[model samples]
Target: MWRELAAIGRETSTGGYRRYAWTAADTDCRSWFRDQAGARGLSHETDRNGNQWAWLGDPAAGDAVVTGSHLDSVPDGGAFDGPLGVVSAFAALDELRSRGAEFTRPLGIVNFGDEEGARFGLACVGSRLTSGQLTREKAYALTDADGITLPGAMEAAGHDPGAIGPDPGRLARIGAFVELHVEQGRALDLSGDRVGIASAIWPHGRWRFDFRGEANHAGTTRLADRRDPMPAYAETVLAARRAAELAGAVATFGKIAVEPNGVNAIPSLVRAWLDSRAADRATLDTVVAEIERAARDRARSDGVDLSVVRESFTPVVEFGHALRDELNRLLGGRVPVLATGAGHDAGILSAAVPTAMLFVRNPTGVSHSPAEFAAEDDCAAGVLALADVLEGLACR
Candidate 1:
C-alpha cells in the first residue's frame, strides 16, 4: 500500500507530498482510496461533504464502528502524517478477517477530505462540515492564494458545492469513530511504547497579520525617511518567539506573502500567518493577545498600518472518558495515554460523536516535513493494535 501511495503528489526535489485539496494530486489519492475499498470488497460511498467511506456492513444500520483517517498532506509534508492511518486502517481490516472475527455491528473506514487545509487554510473541513462546526456560507467564501474560491475548486474537482452542509443523519449513525495516526511528537518514543492513546488536543488557532506601508525603491529610499513593513513584521516574529517561551506555548509564522515582491523594491505590504497552540484555552488566548500587542506596537513605531484576523481556531478537545476507558481496557490497560498539541479530524468530530485517537511511535518526533518517519515494526504494532480495538468494539 505504501509503495503505491508513495509516488502520488511527491515532489522530486524534497521527496515530500503536496496532496493539496481538490488538486490533481488529491484526486489521485481519492482514486487510490476508492480502489483500496474495492479491493477489500467494502461498499464504497462519498458523503455529501466529500468524505469517503467504505462499509463492510449496512451503513444505515445504527451504531457503526468506524476507523480511518485523512489522506491529504501539508506543503512538502512527510510520508506518514496522514497516509499511515489510512494504510493501517485497511491492514487492520485484513487482520480482523484473518482472525475470523465476526462483527455484530457494522464496520466502516473513512478517508476524510481536506484534512490538512494546505489549500483552504481550514483544517478538518470535511469533518467540520459534517459535524456542523463550519457553515456552508462561510465555507463558500474561502479563497486560495490564486484567487480561486472554494466552491469553484470543488466544482472543478467534480464535487457539488451546493450539496455541502451539515450531515446530521450520517453523523448520527456512527456509534464510535477511531482514528489511528503516526504520532506528531515523541510521547510514545520517550516512553518506549509503540502505541498510545490520545487524551486531549491543545487549543490552537491561526491568525493573519496584514501590515501596510509605502512602496519605494530599496536602493534610493533613506532608512530614516522610509516606512517599511518588513521591519515591523520581522520584530513581530521575534516577539512571537519570546511570548511563546514565556507562556510555555508554541507559535510560528510559517506562511507569508508580500505585495509587489521584488529584490530591488520595498514591499508595500507584508501578510503573515501565525499558528499558535497551548495546552489550555486561557494560555493560548493570552499568548496570541501578547503577540498581537507586540505586532501592533512595532507597527505603530514603524509607521505601518496593521490589521489582524483570526482565520481558524479549535478549542481544547477532551476525549470522552467512557470510550477512552473502554479503549484502555481493550488494549489491556498498558498503553500510555498522552495529550497532543496537534489537532486531528478526531478532535473535530469528538463534539458530535464518541471519538478517540491512537498514535504510533515516531522515532524523531518530526512531522509536517520530509524528515517525518516511523519505524516499520512500530507501524506493524499500530496495525495490530487497531485490529484489536476494532475486534473488541465490533466483533463482540
Candidate 2:
C-alpha cells in the first residue's frame, strides 16, 4: 500500500509529498483510494462534501464502525502524516478477515478530502463541511493563492460545487470513528511504546499578520529614510517565539509573502501566517494576544501599519471518555494516552461523532518534512492495534 502511494504527488527535489486539495496530485490519490476499495471488494462512494467511503456492509445499517484518515498532504509533507492511517485501515481489515472475525455491525474506511488545507488554508474542509462546522457560503469564499475559489477548484477536478453542504444523516449513521496516524511528536517514542491513544487536541489557530510600508530601491534608499515592513515582520517573528516560550505554548511563522518580492527592492507589504497552539484555551489566547501586542508595538516604532486577521481557529477537543475507555480495553489497557498540539479530521468530527485516534511511534519526532519517519515494526503494531479495536467494536 505504501509503495503504491509513495510515488504520487512526491516532489523529486524534496522527497516529500505535495498532495494538495483538488489538484492533479490529489486526484491521483483519490484514484488510488478508489482502486484500493475496489481491490478489497468494498462498496465505495463519494459523499457530497467529497469524502470517500468504502463499506463492508450496508451503510444504512446504523452504528457503523469507521476507521481511516485523509490522504492529502501539506506542502512537502512527510509520507506518513495522512496516508499512514489510511493504509493501516486496509491492513487492519485484512487482519480481521484473516482472523475470521464475525461482524456484528457494518465496517467502513474513509478518506476525508482536503484535511491538510494546503491550497485553501482551512484544515479538515471535507469533514468540517459534513459536520456543518463550515458553511457552504464560507467554503465557497475560500480562495487559493492562485486566485481560484474552492468551488472552482472542485469543479475543475470534476466534483460538483453545488453538492457540498452539511450531511448530518451520513454522520449520524456512524457509531464510532477511529483514526490511526503517525505520531507528529515523540510522545510514543519517549514512552517506549509503539502505539498510544489520543487524549485531546490542543486549542490551535492560524492568524495572518500584514505589515504595510513604503517600497523603495534597497540599494539606493537610506536606512533612516526608508520605511520597510520586513524589519517589523522579522521582529514579530522573534516576538512570537518569545511569547510562546513564556506562555508554555507553541507558535510559528510558517508561511509568508512579500509584495515586490525582489532582492533589490524593499517590501511594501510583509504578510505572514502564524500557527499557534496551547494545551488549553486560556494559555493559547494569552500567547496569541502577547504576540499580537508585540507586533503592534514593533510596527509603531518601525513606522509600519500593522493588521492582524485570525484566518482559522479550532478549540480544544477531548475525545469522548466512553469510546476512549473502550479502546483502552480493546488494546489490553497498556497503551499510553497522550495529548497533541496538532489538529485533525478526527478532532473536527469529534464535535458530531464519537471519534478517537491512535498514534504510531515516530523515532525522529519530525513531521511535515521529508525527515519524518516511523519504523516498520511500529507500523505493523499500529495495524494490529487498529485491527483489535475494530474487532472489538464491530465484531462478535
- Model 2 C-alpha lDDT versus the unseen true structure: 0.95
Candidate 1 lDDT over 113-222, as tens digits, reads 99999999999999999999999998999998898998899999999888999999998889999999999999888999999999999999999999999999999999
Residue-by-residue lDDT tens digits, candidate 2, 1-396: 999999999999999989999999999999999999999999999999999999999989899999999999999999999999999999999999999999999999999999999999999999999999999999999999999999999999999989899999999999999999999999888889999999999999999999999999999999998789998899989999999999999999999999999999999999999999999999999999999999999889989999999989999999999999999999999889999999999999999999999999999899999898999999999999999999999996
Q: How close is candidate 1 to the true structure, as a TM-score?
A: 0.99
TM-score of each: 0.99, 0.99
Residue pair clashes in candidate 2:
none
What are the lDDT figures for the candidates, one per model?
A: 0.95, 0.95
Clashing pairs in 1: none
Residue 390 lDDT, candidate 2, scale 0-100 = 99
